[model samples]
Target chain A: MLRAAGDWTTASIGDAERAIANVVRQARGVKQLNIAGLGQLDTNGAMLLLETAELAGEGQAVALTGVRDEHRRLLEVIAAASVRHTDAPDDGNPVLRVLAEVGETALKLAREGVELLSFSGAATMAIVGLALRPWRIRWRGLVTQLQATGLNALPIVGLLNFLIGVVLAYQSANQLSKFGAELLTVDSVGVGVLRELGVLITAIIVAGRSGSAFTAQIGSMRVNQEIDAMQTIGLDPIEVLCAPRIMALMITLPLLVFFADVMAILGGAVASMFALDITLTQFAKQLQAAVSINHFWVGIVKAPVMAVMIATIGCFHGLKVSSNAASVGQRTTQSVVQSVFFVIAVDAIFSIFFLIIDV
Target chain B: MTSDIPASTHPLAIHVRGLRTQFGSHVVHDDLELAVRRGEVLGIVGGSGTGKSVLLRTIIGLNRPAAGEIEVLGHLTGTGGAAAAKAIRRRWGVLFQDGALFSSLTVAENVEAPLREHSNLSPRLRREVAELKVALVGLPPDANDKYPAELSGGMRKRAGIARALALDPDILFLDEPTAGLDPIGASNFDLLIADLQKSLGLTVVMITHDLDSLYAICDRVAVLIDKKTRIDTIPELMKINHPWIQEYFGGPRGRAAIASAERAGAAV
Candidate 1:
């Protein structure tokens, strides 16, 4: 195979085929005909080769060469694979066509992934620059965002956690009654609230809410070249931009998680009071007794880790934003998905580490 | 001592020598040398992507130059991360091509952006400074309360200029100051610049393609070519036989220059 150079110009298949036919006609005694230096082929070249080869009456043959990667891939597109029969023009393999389309789709996906990776790399460089200078926080921006992310997120987090506890208490009671182990329901409610639901729900919420918001905010800045402006004004975009968000989330998320856990347990207590006629005093005692410090800390630790992951991933995606409206959506969605995925992955890693340590 | 000016005349506003900025394989500026005196207007005219913006950006540390020495307002040239540039930012102001005022803020708040960022001045002071600029630019008092979206094209451009002038900078850089404005509005901006230069002793550097603008107010002009300052002096530009420059100031654009010269001759 002859390698196509950068300046290679594509020829139509018909033209190449005509050239091939002329070459074949000229060289009457040659056994094997190889065409090279045509560089890359379009359909006009490919089809001409197929047709001319099919029509070789006596002792002439030609094999097409010098197909570039893209040319070969396009030929694999089923249009010029050469027909099975001259009798039926319509009876080409349908599966091959479908497979070609699938291949093209896969290529598109690969291209998009590469594009995203490059963008992420650019932002990573900018963030690294900011990280080198730690004291560049825009305090007002930080305060405003913190109030929005933390103080404003409180009521929803509180109510959601409280209700989650109620569900856990009621559900555990339902299963326990069959085995006459209703007391175990208290342990289940306590464990679930303190050790799992609280952290998971808060992470999901933060991932959904704050993650997208960060992406939008930074994405808009990214689009506006405000991030570039920051750089120009002797400010590290990441330190003035990313570090604050990351720090705020780290500080706030744990508190939110702790609140969510307490509220969920309270929810469970309320359900216990209604279902089992257990007094708030008795419910509180059972919750405290059933939940070990280990269990509480397990979920509590996940909060800060999850928070860091969320804020970092969100800011990372935001900084990756391109100079348009579409990249804003793309980065915001990517940020949310990536943050949630990272939070879950980190949570699992921590859970296993804790288990390995016998914590 | 240069032949154009006496030995005692020192250009205090900006002194740039051998400024070269390259991005990857593209050299945006190469060996660009320019000096604009205090209380002078230097209009830089170049087509799009010719490093007009890059030159202004490099001087103020918005874009990093690969090799150069730029002294603006008695400070060394620093790139996007230059601390010296930050310290000198209050003394220099820039009006972007698109105004580029923060969309979230009202006109008054937008004008106060630099002041608010760099100063510990109270709200009242910021407000007073904002009001002064607004009035100086001839924007109505009510224009301050309106968002950027509420303003027309000329209004936005004026607001942007007002913001640039908020700190009463020693050197002001404007990128396409009157681009997309009506003829009358453009002339109005030019007259305003002339008035400001006279009253404030302000040194102005404007990047524009408008011939009327250059003739109307600019004390001198620098022409950029191939992303570099091809001709630093206007007479040197006349002697140079570059196609675009000749076409720009000779073929069609020469009419304006000839007319302006005739007007000067008639006045004499």
Candidate 2:
């Protein structure tokens, strides 16, 4: 027999748990719980008492003696409400868990690949349909997206490429001067900036900025049931929302890349004037001789493809959002990651193609 | 052993005096005063934009009043030191409308959060307590492992109630507990609240617009009027001769609720 005294309520349970545990340990296999001395009893306290009885009685319900009229019902209720203990889900082996995680991740990636393919197909169909009937297109939304994704992105893209060009010119001029070829810095800066760095950097920046924005905007709309409302109203969300954003990005990205190329070469000229004591005319002459127009076109050609990849990735993840704010946050993060990853991968592919074809 | 701990000498669970709440140039409450008795369900009702939630938020120290003396469980809310405030806070639980369960946690983990934060109970014990709380709130056993997003509207509110009751608090504050529930679900929730209050001997302060809930479970109703409050029993409040009060209880919906409650009372 064990004496259950003192307040069993939440107000005192924090202090009483240790004492109760001690008693339960000492009273192992005890079959009777005496509660005549019990103070105020609430749900927490009753739960504690019931747990104590079960523990003391070796996982069996124990009888209560001296149960007062007031406390009897509470004790009975709590006992009936005791949660049936179930084994926690088997996390058993660390090595197996890690293997499972790897498999899950690979599966998720494959599923994402398939999803992206289907999304691209649908978007292409929408674009082709719109192209066939230009009057059916939403010109206002396309123009707005153009202004947002393109015009608004100009300053940052231009400034970043310009800075990259300055750094490239300074660093290359220093390296080339070691070989008594300081004039060749213009070639490295022009070819490298135009063919790779300028477009690559612009794509990355746009992926982080506009790509993430697309995901968050559309994902939140999905969460708010705005997408469902549009569908119910006989409007296709893909045609109405995704198509405009994609077209705008496709139109803007090349312009942005071209603008970036010009700004970077101009920056290289400025840097050459400072670093190599060469005038703008001399630098421009060297650039004209060093880089073919094909290098600029090579970079420009990658922009539209990268834009489609980024915008489609963004819109795909956005449309995948389930009905919650947390999913919106998660899908937005995924959109950014996938877009940036694809952008770099496509850039690598373009580089390889150019290499094979001897551009 | 627990009897030696210091108890609040005051009879009231909450006491507010001269509470002045405002947002910039707009005044919400002016010198509003309220006192909630121990072990009673007090319902706060008001018209739209009448600052009912603001008042509840102020009493719980979420909103800082422009000027007031707000005491909850004998501790001055904002004026008290952190330790004192936290102590008082632990003694009460507030359930916001829309369940507001942490989307990240499963239902059981959501209930265990307060226990984890405030108590030194063992992990097994905490889980047991959480499970019991969930069961007590009438949630299904499977709901313990399910995330809040998976639960339906009514189930989400029940999960919220389970979290609120996890601490076995002396006072429970519910903000529109039955707002979005269907009529049957709302009344069932009211009955569940009334049952919990009776069993736990809790002091409940509820903010609601549901006249049926007010009629069904409220011990007394506090009507927010003219930027202040008029506190009285429902029948007494009905006799106040004020226009808003008259229109409120005498309104068609209110009359229907009263009639339904009368029928329920007669059946009982």
What local lDDT score does residue A252 receive in model 2, on the 0 to 100 scale?
A: 94
Number of the top candidate by TM-score?
Answer: 1
Note the chain A TM-score of all models in turn: 0.65, 0.84
DockQ (CA atoms), all models: 0.20, 0.01
Write candidate 2's Cα lDDT for A1-359 as tens digits.
88888788899999878977987888898889999998899998888888888889997778989999999898888878889889988888999999999999999989989988999999999999999989868787799889989999999999999999999999999899999999999999999998999899999999998999889888877775456434322246798789999999999999999999999988998999998999999988888998999999999999999999999999999999987899988988999998999999999999999999999
**What TM-score does candidate 2 get on C-alpha atoms?**
0.54
DockQ computed for model 2 against the true two-chain complex using alpha carbons = 0.01
What's the lDDT for residue B74 in model 2?
73
Superposed by TM-score, candidate 2 places the C-alpha of residue A182 at a distance from the truth, in angstroms, of: 3.3
lDDT tens digits, residues B200-249, model 1?
A: 88899999988878777877888888655653445567678888887777
Span of 10 residues, lowest total lDDT, candidate 1 chain A: A1-10
